[model samples]
Target: MADSPEDTIAAIATPPGFGGVGVVRISGPNTAALARAILGRLPAPRHATYAPFLGEQGETLDDGIALFFPGPRSYTGEDTLELQGHGGPVVLDLLLSRCLALGCRAARPGEFTERAFLNGRLDLAQAEAVADLIEAGSAQAARSARRALEGALSHEVNALLDALTGLRVSVEAALDFPDEDVDILREAQVQARLADLSGRIDRLIRGAAQGALLREGLRLVIAGRPNAGKSSLLNRLVRREAAIVTHIPGTTRDVLRETVSLDGLPLHLVDTAGLRESDDPVEQEGIRRAWAEIEAADAVLLVVDDALGEGEEEAAIRARLPGHLPVICVHNKIDLTGRVPGKQGGVLYLSAQDGQGVDSLREHLKAQAGFSGGEGLFLARRRHLDALTRTAGHVATARDALAVGAGPELVAEDLRLAQETLGEITGRFSSDDLLGRIFSTFCIGK
Candidate 1:
């Protein structure tokens, strides 16, 4: 179904500032009327017509290309118009003002895409991929976003939903026909199917987890005693002198952060002050902040100077780190120790000063992040992961119930819950508030 044409909306679709060309997009029932008024004639549907844009007083505002898409075929599944003109801000503003003056209201942020979703042109996940594609930081991320927009994730989710639906029907049928001698719930074939479904859900969860990692990169915090080459390691990872390198201990009295793409994976690296008891108030504050970063980090790179080896100080730092967080023990300054650069016993040995063994650290970080080079991947948000996790939990519970010969009602309820939870990913089951919150984060015109 297409959106109603009565309440038309308009926006400058192109980004702000000067460019080779700018575009003003309009959609609604009034699109044709607006086109005739501005372009002097309704453009041929889906054709690019060169024309002059006219103001209220019959004056030429700008000369450019006008494109029209009729209802049920446009992006919003409504009558749509796009005016391509010069990229100057003033020119675009004049064009937009002319649109508003012609009774088209300015579009809300992401209203265009929202309308498309509402009109059944795209599902919720694909709509989100529109924004992810625009903000993608790497080629891999962009490709993943494109795949998601093309319905890769939605297809898998719907397949799971279909399987769940079939299982639910069979369970309910068994409940309805209690006189049957052979109990479907206790059948070996049914149990096998349930196990297979659980396996499929687990596989989807792993893929979604990887996609989530690609969407939101890892936060890695570097921590150790002063002058352990923590700052040098940060500089080496980012390929820049992002942090000050000094011989003096406690030279870095604050946290320094740098974002770098490590093999198509976004790596947020934070360098913190040397962790130790300090008499100075400023250094004490720095140490406090450093611990705070470690607490919130996805992983920590615990740097240990090769000269110092794994001493009491390193042990103490290890004891303080969060037990659940992944900690990569980095043995730095291996050049001086004449040790080869590589990973040994889950610890990375390298020289940050000489750029030795950094590649090993990169691979280790990627492995820790569960990033698989973005192949067969799709962009996913934290909410998507949450939904997938919840769905998997419900499916597992259903399988367990089936194994225990639980009542059909219990199994059916679990299957139903799992289906609905999975549906949230593509918005087959969603609330208005959730939709509002998701679209609000998108930029205007998209």
Candidate 2:
């Protein structure tokens, strides 16, 4: 971790591969000294200079561009150096070795961004957006992450925090002056303010839920009896033959998974073996795995033969599914049944073979995941949603306490807890373990 300003850290910033150029990044108090040792002269602040990188023995190791950024105005709010050179595994490794020899320790995963957070260059939500932007599954996701990185989410949180602080101060003032006739908790204006804050938090929570769905995506399990075109449906959704499709009843004896984007929403598609009893050990094992997948899926797409409609096997399979899991009855092979290709009453009639009604399925999946392709959505994580939920809970408690004419102290305490919960979203009140968990998920040299 980049926890100290004195401990210089370095790492190959560019991904490992032979490219036109690669970079070695170093940051800390000793960055200037390391640059002087490796480049023979310190580059001008915030300027890139073409220079020869040298080893300890004063031998030229590589020719590259050197950039220097002085502390307090850099990415990590510390002196940082970037050495750009030919992107070769051997060459980059040699350059990194030279930096280590010059007293720079290797940086941990996301240490660069972590340092930026600790140094106040970015809040927790913004820091997380860095990783989200890097690993965005779609353009919409990238846009959302960019909004979060630009302080869209943090701005909302700060505004809510300010409101909470103001209300808490008012309550405390009334508590301090018992001699005064000011009944802060019972005041209509105070109740209105609390109601306004709650409404704002509610709107933010809805947007955050959509953002979280975009980030984590939905896990959909496709299961049905043999010859129900389960594999065909999977192939149509993925736009390729991801799963082997055949006329055989039990052709597929394993669960196949493919991740695809449906209208900018990531869908983790799982195609399981046809759900049924089988004497063959392989088929039995596949059925077992299919049930396991159904148990954990966010949603299930039960593909059934339109000719047979819902039968005993379908009922049996449905009975095994987790009661809480949402199911979309997919009447596959509708082409053969002469049924129109569309959705009605929560059932989708489609032919997976000729792509009939697949678009409706895609739309249904997006709707089920609660994704709306729109602007102003900031990327958020589960923890952020949890914090917002807790904040809302506290605010609701305070509202109720005031409505019932509870003591000013109780209302103030609820407001205080609400403020602290909101602080966690922007990293103002995060635990060390939470920080470690959040940063460790990022790639090295972030």
Candidate 3:
């Protein structure tokens, strides 16, 4: 692995397989030399020049466009080279091999982006957004990731850090003058400022939760008694024959999972075995697995036959589910029961066979996940949420200390902790282990 930003690294920037064009990216101190060695002489800065890629024997490897970007003004704040050539796998591999032979080592997964973060071209949050943008599953997710890459999340974190710093400064100053008549806690608006900071953190946390949902999505478990149209509902949601639909009660004997996006939000639909007591051992094991899925699910969709309405089985399953878990009661096969196709009193009446009232269920799912599509959402991860929550906790403790007239030393320490926690979100104060784990998930050449 390239240990330092000074080390030169190269990789195939584009994805694998044949395409019209492929790009090989090189960055670090050796970029200028490597470019000159391959292209005969360094190309003008930021300008693409048609050139021939030559092997060590001075023989033509392939003709392509070469562009050079000098240090401190480039993506990684270092000299960078991009060679655009035919997308043929062998040709691209040869080009990369030629560059490696010229003293450029292969780039590690996410190393290019890691270098960008190290050089201050992008902060930690923005660096993660680069990967998020590449892996975004929906148009909304892409837009959200783009906003985060533009430093939307870092901006909020930095603002919170600044506020904490200001509060700490005031407290430290007051500590220096122990005999002052007016306490800094009272004069500096410490309590009010802390309250406002706490509120701001709360609002940011809400937005981040939604963004996280956009990224990781919700695990939606479809569960109920046997022959409750569970397979039909799963098929309808995914718009395919994903699950084996049959009138037989025990047709589905195992869990089937499919991920579907609902208006930019992703729902990991898990079609589980019917939840009913059975004499057969196979059916019993399936029910056990269904319960396991329900336990881990973020939300549950309880599908009940509209003709059967609510019954002992439905009530039993609902009672068995975790109290905190969100459940959307779905009344499937409404076309047979002559029931209205809409949501009424927390229950969605829909027909899975003909796809009636499914839109209401989708809306209810969105509402359950608290995903209200809006602008300016920053792509966030679970780690970011944990940091924000910790920061808020520290702020709350600091506020409590101030409210009770606690000494400036204690209040100041709490504020400092709060500031540090916020810094972790943007990598202003992060551990080496955290950095390694975050970057390791990215694909090579990112």
Best by lDDT: 2
lDDT of 3 by residue, 1-446 (tens): 43666679999999899999999999999998888889999999998899998888989989899999998899988899999999999999999999888888899888889988888899999999998988887788899999999988899889888888998998887788876566743545888888899999999999899899888778888878899999888878878323222111123433466677787787877776645679999878877776776687898899999899889998987887888788888999989999999999888999999999998888888888889877878899989999999999999998888778788899999988998889998899999899989888887888
Evaluate candidate 1 by giving its C-alpha RMSD to the native, one decimal.
5.8
| lDDT (Cα, tens digit) per residue for candidate 2, span 1-446 | 54565789999989888999999999999998899999889999988899999988999999989989998899999999999999998999999999998888999889999999999999999999999988887787789999999998999999999999999998887788865456743367789999999999999999899888878778898879988998778777777423222111123433476677776677877776655579999878877776776677899899999999999999988887799998899998888999999998878999999998999888888888888967877889888999999999999999999889888899999999999999999999999999998888887888
Better of 1 and 2 by TM-score: 2
Query: TM-scores of all models?
Result: 0.86, 0.91, 0.88
Task: Write candidate 1's Cα lDDT for 1-446 as tens digits.
Answer: 34333679999999899998999999988999999999999999999999999989989999899999997899988899999999889999999999999988888878888889989999999999988888787788789999999998899998989999998998887888875466753456567877888788788778778777887789898878888989888878878423222111123433466667776677877776556689999878877777776787899899999988888877877788889888889999999998889998878999999988988888889888878874788888888889988998998898788778788899899999999999999999999899988787777787
The runs of at least 3 residues in candidate 3 whose Cα sits more than 4 Å from the true structure, single-residue gaps closed, are 1-4, 184-188, 240-255, 273-294, 308-324
Which runs in model 2 stand beyond 4 Å of their true positions? 1-5, 184-186, 240-255, 274-294
Question: Of the candidates shown, which would achieve the greatest TM-score relative to the real structure?
Answer: 2
lDDT of each: 0.84, 0.86, 0.86
How far in Å is the alpha carbon of 148 misplaced in model 1?
A: 1.3
Of 2 and 3, the candidate ahead on lDDT is 2
Q: How high is the lDDT of residue 309 in model 1? A: 89
Deviation from native of the Cα of residue 60 in model 1, angstroms:
2.1
For model 1, the superposed segments whose C-alpha errors exceed 4 Å read 1-6, 182-187, 240-255, 273-294, 308-323
